[model samples]
Target: MRGPRRLRLPRTRAGWRRLTQAVAAGCVLALLPPTWLYVTTGGRAGTVAGAPRTDVAVVFGAGLWDGEPSPYLAHRLDAAAALYRAGRIEVVLVTGDNSREDYDEPDAMRTYLVRHGVPDARIVSDYAGFDTWDSCVRAKEVFGVDRAVLISQGFHIRRAVALCRAAGVASYGVGVADRHDVTWYYGAVRELFAAGKAALDVTFEPDPRFLGPKEPGVRRALADAGRRPAAPLPRDAGR
Candidate 1:
């Protein structure tokens, strides 16, 4: 016997309209992560504040020219340089990518800081800060820095803060005027998306490019890594 005819659902104009709206809503829902990050990060956080501060201020990597820092990188360096002069941090950890044949962001960052009056002794360049996550992890394990002042554009500082915290670095936020002068109006839109990605990087386990030998002892690898070299980063970094 033939099975009862299956009834077809209506595909009328209104039904199509409802379906389209539902899909649109789902797309919007998919954007929740970025939206949450954007909504939460406002203005800047505390500036070189009191006691909780420590030995290092990790200046994340930006652009480089052969071995020179990009203009954008210069701004971050200056901000970090200023903090160093103020005695907020005892040392500066410059971390950046050196993946290519000659592009070295960390060394460039260190040189820029030195020219700005920060001494080389006070700077340790990590030639493998593949990203904020790499820098945060290396800072805690390789550099032995338990706390740090994270300098970056205002919109990026919050995400950087979260990433550092997850990596076990007691990260604090310090804003450097964004490379873009003026508010740039709706700039928050892009920043929001960036924050979402930063949020995930916390749990994301990625290896440092040049993690050196002499990693921690068999008994206390946890404590030993805290003294590891700083990790490096890339330019136009999503952080």
Candidate 2:
């Protein structure tokens, strides 16, 4: 038998140029979603002091450390707590992954918030927030949150706001510092793909991982937080 035929490759200069152009075009297309998310939500995320008061402050989970919240997570909780104390948000919904018994993110988040002076009655724990999309979907479907203040790091808040809004919770965001460390940089890099995924999620509108009958969590939490008025915030609130 003849030796395996040499695989024919694009040998011409024009063919190589076309291949390069195609790759460049693909990269540009991939970047569109991240660009769109940043532009659309840039104005909506800011410091906690600038965030508008909403019906609930949805604190998305960062990682945990030794059965406690990591510093990044603690920062998010701090912002939510400040929002609570300022009377800007009526309730705090701690949403995180709790798939494993030993690594319970939501429970750890709730413990941190409670220890920081947030009343347990005003804290609603969402144990199924496996991802940003899951948290956004469950917040709307299970928790009955129509509007919310999202809390996360600066690099992530725009995507959070976009995903939550697409999930039908009219939402703003409070972005904490990015920390400028290895973890923060890794998260920022990951957000490029995450933003693209979010765009597709918004387009397809997939159901959440878990959906149950609407619980009274949102209403009860708000009532327990003293039924803070949902008045319109100043235009500069989202500065």
Best by lDDT: 2
| TM-scores of the models, in the order given | 0.70, 0.90
Cα displacement (Å) at residue 27, model 2: 1.5
Per-residue accuracy of model 1 over 1-239 as CA lDDT, tens digit each: 99999976657999888888999998786677665554443332455443133457888886776567766677778878887677555678888888887788877787788898887767877777887777777877777766667887666677777677667766667766654544433455666666657756654656656567423321142233243443332111222
Candidate of highest TM-score: 2
lDDT of 2 by residue, 140-177 (tens): 88988877889999989999988887887877888898
Residue 140, candidate 1: how far off, in angstroms? 1.2
lDDT values, one for every candidate: 0.66, 0.86
Worst 10 residues of 1 by lDDT: 230-239
Candidate 2: worst-modelled 10 consecutive residues by lDDT: 230-239
